[model samples]
Target: MADGNGSEKEAVVVSNKQVVIKNYVSGFPKESDMEIITGSIKLKVESGSKAILVKNLYLSCDPYMRLLMRPQGWEEYSLLKSSQGLFKIEHTDVPLSYYTGILGMPGMTAYAGFYEVCSPKKGEYVFVSAASGAVGQLVGQFAKLFGCYVVGSAGSKEKVDLLKNKFGFDEAFNYKEEPDMNEALKRYFPQGIDIYFENVGGKMLDAVILNMRIHGRIAVCGMISQYNLDQPEGVHNLMSIVYKRVRMEGFAVFDYYPQYGKFLDLVLPNIREGKITYVEDIAEGLENGPAALIGLFSGRNVGKQVVVVARD
Candidate 1:
């Protein structure tokens, strides 16, 4: 326990194993790009600093984490930003790892992107790409809760089934099997998409453009498909946005952190009563972090991927 002076009765040090990016990645990240190195840190908060010392129990494995691994301006800020959202682990029935998924950043993202950006209405046709992912799964669920007809697209048949059965999506299809995305969207949403939760971008965005209704809203959350590409694929459909008066907006979860308290109020009860559910692919130990993160690009993870650093 910390005292008034921000010091523990006795100093304690522990070996801290970290998975760090060795260099800026050129294309798709490999397990070799990150190395697990052992270091040591004092388990005490600094006397004057505002920093809170936390025993990191779980780390989130998100597709956006790839952006931080690349050559970016001030990578430490990305790390610190996530640290800012940490929740203390006390007595709880839920898994501690839930903080890294549905109950935390990803949940906030889905909430903000759908409600704030897309402004969905009841009976609206909502389509979520990569719908089995951390954010997308929640987005599809939120749309259902809001009384919208929701369809999800996933890579594998198993994931599509999870989206339909577990997450309660109105319709779900394996995107890998659907070579023509436009035809697939037409099959699922014959009336045309009112709100398109864009995740897997690229050619999907182009196909979605042709299927969007007049005055449609597109919440650009992520583009996992183009993240590893040397040159991102171009979407030749800007004319549709003008012709249909479509509104497309990109957003970051950090901007909506202030509404977290309200978000919890709305979601917690649903989660507790079994009205909402989430999926996670947890990898044990810090040493496995590299592999867990690298697996995301290959669609190896079924849902939200998490890496456990310590059980307690």
Candidate 2:
């Protein structure tokens, strides 16, 4: 084993492979848009930077990763930017790739967005769109732990089943089969939605808006449905935002990272106790990263998508 200085009596040079974004992307990024280059791995950490050097093991494939691959577009400070909350992964069990989904940004996204933004209360009726995805899955579980009646929507029948059986959602439905989102919302939330975790956006948001109880809250995490399209579908029921006196706000997880420790305190115990469950679809090797990423928009991943780069 190396000493604290990260070196032995003799200097050692280790080969390193890094996954680099080919460049900013346009439309859906292809496999060619990313390339893994080899280099030397430094065993030492630099001073004055909170950025820790990680030997990446499990990298996540999230829908928001699309924006980063996009040729610099209009998307704001999300996973897209030159140095935004992009994943230059390095995960392991101790600091594993699974952490990237449950304990990383997605975890924080669920914590801050649910606790701070949604501010859910016991017995509240909470509904989450794309509830089987990374952030949404955690949000639903958190809501359940908060003693709320939680429901979720997913694209496939299997995912819907997973949400209900595995994630402990009170109810779940396949949005693909539901011809009308409003109907699905009503069916699951007859009492009306007190908290709506917006993920898919577009029609789903509109549908949730119509069913939101008075003084309801909405945490807008993303709009995956509109990401690839040149022109996104507009919400015709925006007026409902005013009439319902609903509070709707969008958020990015990075701004809330400072409180990550506190959030983890609240979640880790539950995770260890089996009170909370997280899902991940792991892709091995950098070569599979592209397909894993592209498949996100199509709901090809059952839960959080992770890519493994190297192992210790």
Candidate 1 local Cα displacement, residue 302, angstroms: 0.9
Model 1 lDDT per residue over 146-186, tens place:
99999999999999999999999999999889878889889
Best by lDDT: 1
For model 1, what is the error of residue 14's alpha carbon versus the real structure, in angstroms, after optimal superposition? Answer: 1.5
Candidate 1 residue spans exceeding 4 A from truth: 1-10, 70-91
lDDT of each candidate versus the true structure:
0.86, 0.80
**Candidate 2: misplaced stretches above 4 Å?**
1-15, 36-54, 70-95
For each candidate, what TM-score against the reference? 0.91, 0.83
User: Against the hidden true structure, what lDDT does model 1 obtain?
Assistant: 0.86
What C-alpha lDDT, on a 0 to 100 scale, does residue 221 get in candidate 1? 93
**Candidate 1: pairs in clash:** none
lDDT of 2 by residue, 136-169 (tens): 9999999988899999989998999999999999
